[model samples]
Target: MTNLIRKLWVPVMTLMAITGMGQMPIFKRYYVADIPGLAWLGEPFTVHWVHYAGAAVLMFMVAVITIRWFADREPLTTSGTLRITLLALLICTGYIRVVKNLPDIHFSPTFTMLIDWTHLLFAMLLGVAALWSARTGRRSYTKQTESLRRI
Candidate 1:
């Protein structure tokens, strides 16, 4: 349970940071592929931002349960389990960028170059965060079970 709380803390904080960033207009019309692009009527930032926000909310609940488990000296709850599933989706999102789609937008070469660089940099950050969370989450489950068995 202590491990669970430790594992969930980073992801919850990351999700909160992502949501608090509000919508960054990274791509306007087209998506990086695989992810559904924005429609003519809707803005891309809003959709992407909402997805990240939803993920944060789900992670927040997981964090709450994990903290509770640690406090009560109980097993990590299903909230922790659900968070693992969400982490898998985040991994898939990273893979999608590698395979079917990389976001491209035609812009003034100077600005576009900077944008591309910035985007790739942020992508690396996200990839690292997602993998770390998944690995940590898995370890959390293992620790919980092992500890429970000792009792």
Candidate 2:
């Protein structure tokens, strides 16, 4: 469990922020719409925000733990780069599995679709970051290894 968290977790707080914000209205106005479940559940938008907030908080905690403690070293170094890439991919997967799948669990069409797109955008950014970080780390490692061999 510790290894899994350390090796394969990067939580995106933006998702949490989006969901939490979406759900806030649900607590107050309840649903103005006639969707049967929406009213009973107290505004799906609110529910979305609440869900997002919870996810955000959980992700934030995990991220801090992984970065501060589990990571073992800074990502700018070669050994740490692999760990960072894995963490980023895991986060991307979570966005697909968690927020993107919320529509199936709830009845908010707009909320569901909107979140999916946002998650996709985040995934793209993560992909780029992972690639760049990994390449830089590899180059640095190669240079160090070559210098040591020459010495």
Candidate 3:
């Protein structure tokens, strides 16, 4: 189960990142809508819904991984600590963005844009961190296997 989750980590993060990018107004107007079949992506609500759904999936995956890590008493390395910090900040910003989107709530345009930009920045950083973690994990696994073969 842990292995499966590890394998899925990168792909899921990539999907979430793409959907998040699609929500950007400029990206939608200049790129997404220009694509023939993907014109539907230009619809703000459609992209928002997809992003929300992806977030739910991501939350679940993170929860499971975190729980398993704690249960197994896994050692947290520096990169692991960084990933956790980024995920926590990302979740907080994402929640704020969703709340600010509600009809009853109104924030200043500047504040809203700040939140959006911060969320996007954290997401991009988190994606890079996840990719780096996966690459390093794979390299270490390969080294372990090679060492075992020689002995």
Candidate 4:
């Protein structure tokens, strides 16, 4: 179960990010409609709902993973710690963005843009870190297997 969740974490976050991007006015205005066969992605309202739904699922998954990791007393490597920190920050920024979007809330345009950009930056960093972690894990695994074969 934990292995499955770990495998899914990156792809699910990537999809959420993509759907979130689809809700951006600039993307909708300049790109979404122009792309053939993908025009439906420009529907802001639907995309917004989908993004929210994905966020909810993401939060749940993170909670479960964190709990399981602690319960199992898994050793946290530096990369694992970094990923957890990034995820925490990402979730914080995401919640702020959601609050800013509430009907009665009124953040300054500059503040809103700052939050949006920060969220995107965190997501990109997290994705790169995940890839790096996977690559390093594979390399170490290969080295271990090679040593075993030599023995």
Q: What digit string (tens of lDDT, one per residue) describes model 3 on residues 24-88? A: 77656678577788776788788789889888988888899778666756456677778788989
- Can you write out model 1's per-residue Cα lDDT over 1-151, one digit (the tens) per residue? 5466566656665554443232344343334323564242145456555645555565556667657656767554454444455554554443343333235633466755554455445545655655665766643442356656899
- Can you rank all candidates by lDDT, best first? 3, 4, 2, 1
lDDT of 3 at 102: 93
Q: What is the per-residue lDDT of model 4 for residues 12-128, given as tens digits with 9 covering 90 to 100?
A: 887797886787765668775668976667888877888898898898888887787667564566777787888888899999999998899999999999999999888888778
Give model 1's TM-score versus the native structure.
Answer: 0.32
Please say which candidate is ahead in lDDT: 1 or 3.
3
Better of 3 and 4 by TM-score: 4
**Candidate 2 clashing pairs, residues 3+ apart or interchain:** 19-49, 20-49, 20-53, 22-49, 23-46, 23-49, 26-46
What's each prediction's TM-score? Answer: 0.32, 0.31, 0.77, 0.78
On TM-score, the candidate that comes out on top is: 4
Q: lDDT (0-100) at residue 136 of candidate 4?
A: 78
Residue range 15-103, candidate 2, lDDT tens digits:
44444444435434544444654352455655665665566655765667666543444325554455456556656655755744555
Residue 6 lDDT in candidate 3 = 75
What local lDDT score does residue 79 receive in model 2, on the 0 to 100 scale?
A: 41
Local distance difference test, candidate 1: 0.50
